[model samples]
Target: MALLSLRGLVKRFGDTVALDHLDLDVAPGEFLTLLGGSGSGKSTLLRVVAGFETAESGAVLLEGRDIAAVPPHARPLNMMFQSYALFPHLSVAGNVAYGLKRDDVPRAERDRRVAEALALVRLQGFERRLPYRLSGGQKQRVALARALVKRPRLLLLDEPLGALDANLRERTGFELRALQRETGAAFIMVTHDQNEALALADRVAVLEAGRLVQAGPPRAVYERPATRFVAGFLGGANVLEGQPDGAGGFDCPGLAATLRAEAPVDRGTAACALRPERITLRPSPLAGANASQGVVEEVAFRGDDSLLLVRAAGGALLRVGHAEEDGAPPPRGSTVHLAWEAAAVVPLRG
Candidate 1:
């Protein structure tokens, strides 16, 4: 059975809708990441689930029971915020044991649980250390330990690694996932970072303009988006609009070429999303199926790869990913040929 479910959830802030009839389910022991931009309602959904905010309509169900009426403290879940929210005056042990004390747990049990939680987060010897003495990553782990110490049925992480440096964030993400697996607890994380979401989630749920745009495994959603917004948002794919020629192809005016679609698309005006990595660039002019000639407008050298912005014959700006081993990317203003397989073009719905 699903561990948690959101049914027809709707929330508003007087003039703007934050959640529009959103429906989502979290499987038991699953790591689900809610991904979206600011104002996309990802954070709002997490708050509603945690009972920090109540929805105007719809139900928040935990284990098939409606939890809309439950208070935050009474719910079988815990939320760890981005800020860590640690008490500067309290030691790591104190911060982690605060919940147990409030719930009137036995002193001996609280001590045992606090030790176990600290050990789970690799903060075993830091029990006496105050929050001010801990590094950013340590502080995050302290907060995580506090949330996990309660043994909640589900855990909500609101940008848990947002405050850390890129390298530390990546390492902490790995540790966080390991901790979740060790405890076998369900986790619902909210984040605007695409790479983090894709890397940590067992499944990713994308929100757009207060609506659930797409939800699936990372590879599925990244490779085959459901709409134009999803295609452009998830991976910054190149979306080209053109007329369908009724032969499983599109007449794209931007590239001044007829491109073949990987699958049959609906009739009328259609569009396709092509990822930057799918296009192969060459210095020689290559004329064939799914090919276009363009001039390199800009080049961005990432450590492992280079991103080339090419202006096609018909003024279409295409971002192409070139590997470092592909003999250093052509200089800006250099003429280039871009080509891809027919299967690389994914059809998009309006």
Candidate 2:
């Protein structure tokens, strides 16, 4: 059995459904991320698992036992909130030791666990400092240490890195993932940030309107999204509608051209979701590739890469990403060609 499992999970507030018959499983020591937009039920699912919210009908099983009836503090799980809920008056060590003290654990054992937790989060020497004295990242570490001090079987993170700056969030992602592996605990984090989810998760569950649209490893979900919502939510996708030409290519009427598709197309109003990064751009169309001619509409600089929005045939706006080697992009209004390999196009049901 999986370390954590949610079966037929459903939650509602009056007429609105927060979660809808969702089923998910987290493997032991796996880092699973529930990714979705606000009101997409990611937080509600976390709250349910944390025992802060009760689902209308479902089973939340931990280690093969249903935990639906357990109280929040009684469950062998810990939650770290986005606010980093560390007590301002207590020193870092004191904050981490609070749980042990509440449970009437021995003083020596409490101190030992507190020290180990602090070390795990790389805040070993900062235990003497108060939350107010630490940087935002440091304070977050204290919160994490406090949660880890108990050595919970599963860690629930609700936007844990949302409070940190971009650089600190990136750094903390590495720390959180490392600490999870070190402690051998399952980590389920909730976030709307697609990049963060893809970066930290062993598997990502994309929720939409209280339903799980897709769930898989980051690459699988991003490269082969199951639904239109999943395709857009995971990352940028140029969705195109077309009919199969029976030669493993699409007679795409939208783009006014035929494009290569690796798989034999399924019948129906099918579409192709192409990743912008997979499309190459140049001054002219390639000889043996699926190519389109367009005029550069906009050039977006994103540090390591640049996004070129090209207005192609049939006035379709196509996005293309290329390495920003010289950090210079072709000016708007310049004609360009965008091409992708046959294997690059992902066929999807419309």
Clashing pairs in 1: none
Per-residue lDDT of model 1, residues 84-149, tens digit only: 899889999999999999999999999999999999999999999999888999999999999999
User: Which model scores highest in lDDT?
Assistant: 1
Minimum summed lDDT over a 10-residue window in model 2 is located at 281-290
Backbone clashes in each candidate structure, one number apiece?
A: 0, 0
Q: What lDDT tens digits, residue by residue, belong to model 2 across residues 1-350?
A: 79998999999999999999999999989999999888999999999999999999989999999999999989999999989888888998999999899999999899888888887888868878888789888888888988888998899999998988899899889888888889998999998788999999899999998998889999989998877777766787988877888766777765677777676666653788888888887666766437778888899888899888988876788888878874577889998777888778877773
- TM-score of model 2 vs. true structure: 0.95
Candidate lDDT (C-alpha), each: 0.91, 0.86
Worst 10 residues of 1 by lDDT: 261-270
Error of 2 at 184 (Å): 0.4
